[model samples]
Target: MKKKFSLLMLMAFAAAYPQDVKAPDMSSPKWLRNAAISPDGSQIAFSYQGDIFTVPANGGSALRLTIHEAYDSDPVWSRDSKMLAFSSTRYGNKDVFVISAGGGVAKRLTYHSAADVPTDFSPSGDKVIFSSSRLDDAASSVFPTPILSELYEVKLAGGMEKRIFSASAEMAVYNADGSMIFFHDRKGYEDPWRKHHTSSVTRDLWLFNTKDKNYYPVTESIYEERNPVFAGGNN
Candidate 1:
């Protein structure tokens, strides 16, 4: 029942790129991922070395935010760009936390037993969408594999978390207009190299319409596409 570590889990999510794409320069210390621009589009917040960091949008020195030993990543700027919300394991479990954009004490947002990782913020800046398995009955099962990770929204100021949809998703991100959410679901599969060894898996993009309360697949191919964000805007 233990969670299976597939390629998707290690790379975070699968993104479709041209087959001729060159491998990234992993040797450079400045390489980063999950780059989110500020609302004003003047700066970017990203994760590096297990903590969140910020740098000028035009490229400059990076400033470290959290100094905790636990893993911290997936940083997103609030709509107003006054604060930052991200996921961290500082509290002994992966949970969402918010801190001032200018740097200050971080505030814990979710208290779930499992993991609550915020993916993106609504355009209005009133809510945040995240993925978690906190509702699953972990104690009742032997291996406690994350059977399903549903998307939920909680007020940026803090309040009751409401389930937006129940599905086996990995990372969830809200669209620019806040009318829809895109996520990646773990489509279970069997290990090809080892016979009789089933493993937790995922591949496919799912779009959830907030207005209609419906979920549907955007693509049927087996590719991991995740951490999607609205590109090109006034910021």
Candidate 2:
């Protein structure tokens, strides 16, 4: 009983006067890209040096996740924050790749030749939505002469890909209920290098329904409205 009491007192004293420990060395010359917050709001996932990494949200040494020769960018977190979906060119093509949030070997999700850039995960966390420029052969559609893009979703376990929106959609995020998706759209969108030019190529915000497959305009104006996000946890 006396030893137990002493241990308890030591624990109490430590809690009362905790020591500040230094974080891990995070110094790196490589550029950091595509940083994402975990679902629980504890950690952040990012891509650096052609690989994926996770670091403490506050400050600490980052944990490296993926190590590959191919370039990996645009890390998107699952709703549960246990997994991350990113785009990699390791398989000779830019396709979606999923990896554990902690760190591990990444699994390829998409195998198409077209570049599939992961944009967001479904609210249910079962499907991952991405943007692709490769045209779907089944859909007899017509896009701009050179550049064309659309939104698509694939299962986490890997299966048939589904087309969500048939437009030049970028960064499409789903609501909490997964009934609606909000994204920035600019079919044949102009390049950002054209800083001063204001043409019809300006991107607009649009909302699409997953159930009815109906889409409508949220905001349309001369000014470019891109990167639409939900606030208050998409409530």
| Top candidate, metric lDDT | 2
The list of candidate 1 runs beyond 4 A from truth reads 1-33, 136-144, 189-202, 232-235
After superposition of all CA atoms, the RMSD between model 2 and the true structure is 15.4
Which pairs of residues collide in model 1?
Answer: 14-224, 39-235, 187-202
Best by TM-score: 2
User: lDDT tens digits, residues 103-159, model 1?
Assistant: 889988888887887877778887877888756433333233555576788887888
Q: Please give the lDDT score for candidate 1.
A: 0.75
Writing each residue's lDDT as its tens digit, candidate 2 over 1-235 gives 9999999999999999999999766664456877788878889888887888889999898898888889988998888889999999988878998988877778888988888999888888888999887664456366543256788999998988888767778888888888888998765647854666566777789988888988889987777788777774654
How far off is model 1, as Cα RMSD?
A: 13.0
Query: RMSDs, each prediction?
Result: 13.0, 15.4
